[model samples]
Target: MSLFDKFEPLNAQYVRLEAIDANPFAITFDHVLSPTEAMIGDSRILLLGTNNYLGLTYDTEIVTKAVQATRAFGTGTTGSRIANGSYDGHKKLERALKDFYGRKHAMVFSTGYQANLGIISTLAGKNDHLLLDADSHASIYDGSRLGHAQVTRFRHNDPNDLHKRLRRLADVPGDKIVVVEGIYSMLGDTAPLREFAEVKREWGAYLIVDEAHSLGVLGETGRGLAEMQNVEPDVDFVVGTFSKSLGSVGGFCVSNLDDFDILRVACRPYMFTASLPPGVIAATMEALHQLRARPELRLRLIENARRLYAGLTGLGFCLGPEPSPVVSAIMPNPETAFALWSDLLKAGLYTNVSLPPATPNGLALLRSSVSAAHTPQQIDHAIALFEQTGRALGMVPASAATHASHHAAASPSLSVTSA
Candidate 1:
């Protein structure tokens, strides 16, 4: 009888999670010291759940650029891009992104979610087809709903399934757009981009690669999975966000399509939403330059990821497919996952706890992401903490805990705590 009645099920679930000290939907960091450290509720916690892959958030040069831009252009762009929000800095940033991706056209949106929504909804129209990975992000799914396309979902990372679906639409008269991500956010697993590209070509479908998690962490030049897989030429569009590696807020879609500029008026999300602030645009441009100049950051990030992954696996924890910027430890169930997550937080480590329905195949996850700014010592400290907490919670065996303790004791600077 009330408007709030629809949320009864979700409210019950939230209360249950809260009772167990596992509710992670709302958390706040009182102080962010750097990309890898933050203070939360009187505890100085190691930040492992942030997507700051390249760790440029605290870079002095980038900060200076942002400050200068804010002083010059004021705080915000109050109007949508279609109206008074179009500024010279926004245009300049678009030009920079265009050159960075080697694309003929680039359009900027207020946020990464908007970029996916705008691009997907505009590209696939009535009677058209929108094929997406089953494990795609929520933005991709919502974008499909906003459009009039008949959506199809294929198995995640299974190129054969994608090909089969495309083959089924052979007789269809409308255009087809296949959407995938460079790196899946939940599992941190990469797509078979080469195979996907091949299937798109065979089916004559447009391909869109969302590289939000892969940018600045893949390829020699950091163009993401498409560049690493050598399939850049096959991809019709590349969507990415500045909030991740760039340490700023914004989104963009770049393409070489001749009529790409027409989306300025056709894409509802882009045209209706206000553009990114001038300060963010300026800072993102600087961050891009920094990412390009320092290829070593990517190397450091992967090395940290591998070290952390190996440490967790050695301690008898299940992990993702491979070492990546994001490392997730799977738990036996939601309860166990929540317990471990709470234990980790109490041990001065902040990680992301992903529950069922949000995770793949209903598996819960304690997700941790590595950043280039994380020192070797910090990574080892985090490993020792995980070992202590995991062992206390019965997630790790006694023998493995003893082994980890012995290893920790051998290093004078490393100490394992029971907290």
Candidate 2:
């Protein structure tokens, strides 16, 4: 049998996925929304699958700056930053981030994945060891692998497990990097940052917190989980992506270590990859300014999350621990999750379908991400649709193993929908 034939099976299998639609699933002028909201494909559909936590995607000021910078600097950087791609704007943004996060130094990367790749792989050589949460993002795991380091996965969100791994690694030498997410992408759960910080201190290990989804969503100033828990000082390094809350596409690494600047010279990924485009850097800088200046945005985001959580629960949908922007309605398998996602789309709603490998143990998830820009009406409508489609799938039927619990909106909490 041909190797290419193996790839064809994937196509044949998923092609008949239920409720699959052909049209692009983005929004247009038909929807009453800010410029950023216009980016969604399903215009009339309720937006419950976006990571625009603070919903700063369409601030006119940020857009205008992006336009002006693009006009002046052109579209592409045309060269790697290590070569001739570094512009005054790039340096300015880097300095601005250092000041914003109150860190000694910060380096900007083309994308968030690259940030982890460049940082982790550079810090952890072949001789070092990497201790990571089982629930870490794929980027973190891949970067650890690329480093050629000895990788060990600890239990998800379990500090005790991390402690055990650290104790074992204490016998090893060179560097030990402990990696965890600020807010897990699949389960939407947060790490016990303070507890992990203590373990890192006792074990003499370096800590790296990836704040991809948490930045601009957590903390009063929206710095992320470390900032929210007042454990910023304890974390040796902080990595974040601009794609989610910042309403832009970029990544950054901040550290107190001076040698990190040398990563520009030493890191192969950083040296090889082209720098972020001028327009993006411009928009990103503007987004950072807004993130720091507008704490009210974070408040509005939290309120929206609370309201969405309550509504989802009232409609008998399970949610994540605490009121996170990313809430999931988990199903037993991939087929079930895909069907629910399709139904939600048909019901004028949009969300993500998360399945195995991405989510552990083959658990399929109809993940909903609440945005600050989402109105109460939108959330309520989404809840009703979720309840309606979920029931049709026997999700709430008495015979289903996961149908034991009932969700009520009267409580001030998020109920996770799971099997």
Candidate 3:
């Protein structure tokens, strides 16, 4: 049989799973939860790995708006945006985004992934060059390939590398799009926007910033990294999603381009895909408003992240820098990481497990997402669980080496100040 025809292991660590079944933390849940908790199969697990950065999923107002919209518009769109699905709901949501991002216009997509795919693939076509950060989202990679653009990769967050790459493209320019993210999804570090602004100034190429993880989590007004860095005016395009902080399931692109209107008709993904449903539209509008008006949500989220991050490090766990909404605990290898994952589940805490290929440099990760909804008590519980798991797995000794930052912690707590 061909390699493609062969069935692969669902989990490589199945042999050790006898331990999993015996775990007190192996769980199932069946109810709604706050920022730091979830009901899985039947157990209430602390949500240390949710992308619900703002905890807007459980907002009563958003739920009410979604329900109202469903009553008015029924269920699905039933057709693609180009055919018979373009509703007022789409335009309304787009307008709300435009005002929120301080842009003249915005275009919506089915998902953040598609937003990148449609915009990147459609704008930078054949004969173009795409200069992107190596750690950019997969959607960006796919879009660049689909665009058939000549791709050049710069080291993660390394502006000097970007400058060198741009220098090479100086002579040959059909069009070049410098792509980056407001916040990297994996390690949750932010891009150096000012350095990028300087590079683009010299290269004279357009810049696209993906704020899928940054929107509503950074910036004074929830406009994302561009706003936080005061580079919104410098960026050529800003793409983001309703999935993460937006508490919904749509995506958007905001640009000052008169060409943006053109992409609606020219872009195959936007044209062929069914438009967003009314409930998504209505709920998103509510979410965006809350994201802007309620800066407290952002502040609480940062505080929670800092607190959780710090607690993990203090416990001798190797973690990412500063408190980002995405806090990853990297393991030396996939086997060790999987072992840690199984152990964590046994302790009743669930997180994203990063293995090779998915994680660069053969590094595996136990990724946790901090949410504003996590109370001090919930965070403390999760940290205790981590320590327990680490000790049990031999990843750490009973007392550990005490050499690993004996007092490590997430960043300090945060508070959002309104404009």
Q: Candidate 1 vs candidate 3: which has greater TM-score? A: 1
Candidate 2, 1-419: lDDT as tens digits: 87778688656655655235522222233553651233334446566777788777788998899999999999989989888759888899999899988998899998999999888888988898999999888889889878888899999889999999889877777788899898888767878899999999999899999999888877757778888778998888999998999888989999887677888898777889899898899999999998888877776676667766666665555666666888886677777777788777777777888777789656778788887777766666676677778778777543432311322333332222110
Query: Cα deviation of 164 in candidate 1 (Å)?
Result: 0.9
Question: Tens-digit lDDT track for model 3 on 1-419?
Answer: 66743443643344355454522224345665775676766666777776898889989999999999999998889878877857888888889988887788799998888999999999988889899898888899998887878888899899999999888878995887899998887787888898899889888889999999989998888788888887887898999999989778988899997757989888878888788889998999999989988989888888777777777777667776556888888887766766777677656787877655556556778889987778767777777777777887776667653323423443442223321
Cα lDDT for residue 105, candidate 1? 96
Top of the candidates by TM-score:
1
TM-score, every prediction: 0.95, 0.89, 0.91
- Order the candidates by TM-score, highest first — what do you get? 1, 3, 2
Task: List the candidate 3 regions with Cα displacement exceeding 4 Å.
Answer: 6-32, 400-419
Q: Candidate 3's C-alpha lDDT?
A: 0.80
Better candidate by TM-score, 2 or 3: 3
lDDT values of the candidates? Answer: 0.87, 0.78, 0.80
Greater-lDDT candidate between 1 and 3: 1
- Give the clash count for model 1: 0
